[model samples]
Target: MSSIHSVTPTFDEQVPFAAIKERIVQAMCAASLGAVLLFGAGFASMETLHNAAHDSRHSAGFPCH
Candidate 1:
């Protein structure tokens, strides 16, 4: 009878490359979205921006009147 041997993977080989790539893509997308929102709000009219921020604050139960 022949005996079979099992092999264990190292730390670097444990995680798949596809998972790492996905995480990087997600982080980059989030950063890009934040930049766009910040610049867009900065260039928006004062009244419109204030109203939108005010509504958001109230919806979140934060008083800023």
Candidate 2:
């Protein structure tokens, strides 16, 4: 009598390298943009923004500038 052997799949064969790298790059870009927006939003003072040539506090209100 003869017996059959079973084979196991490898990690390299299961996943494609190009697809994985593309996803990673996309996620990194999104994270970077979010971080930049968060950093700019942190400064809520009118003087600080305008003095730095931005003036991002409350969008030209009576108290702004």
Candidate 3:
């Protein structure tokens, strides 16, 4: 009895070269956009917190003046 051997490359070979390249580019763009949005939100929230703290300490009735 003789067995046949498969010569296919697997995963990367399953898809065409152009398609794989397009997917990689799309994923990179999505990651960059996500990073920008996350950092932007964090910075905005930090500034708001700082302003609130400063205002509370400067209230007219406080003895720390």
Q: Cα deviation in Å at residue 51, candidate 2?
A: 17
Q: What is the lDDT of candidate 1?
A: 0.93
Q: lDDT at 61 for candidate 3?
A: 54
Error of 2 at 28 (Å): 0.4
Clash count for candidate 3 is 0
Candidate 1 collision pairs: none
**In candidate 1, what residue range of length 10 has the lowest lDDT sum?**
8-17
Model 3 lDDT on a 0 to 1 scale:
0.80
Per-candidate TM-scores read 0.67, 0.46, 0.46
Give me the displacement of residue 33 in model 3, in angstroms.
0.5
Model 1: C-alpha RMSD to truth? 6.6
Please count the clashing residue pairs in each candidate, in the order shown: 0, 1, 0
Candidates' C-alpha lDDT: 0.93, 0.74, 0.80
Q: Model 2: runs farther than 4 Å from truth?
A: 1-13, 44-65
CA error at residue 33 for candidate 2, angstroms: 0.6
Looking at model 3, residue 38 earns an lDDT score of 77
Off by over 4 Å in 3: 1-13, 45-65
RMSD of each: 6.6, 10.6, 11.8
lDDT of 2 at 6: 94
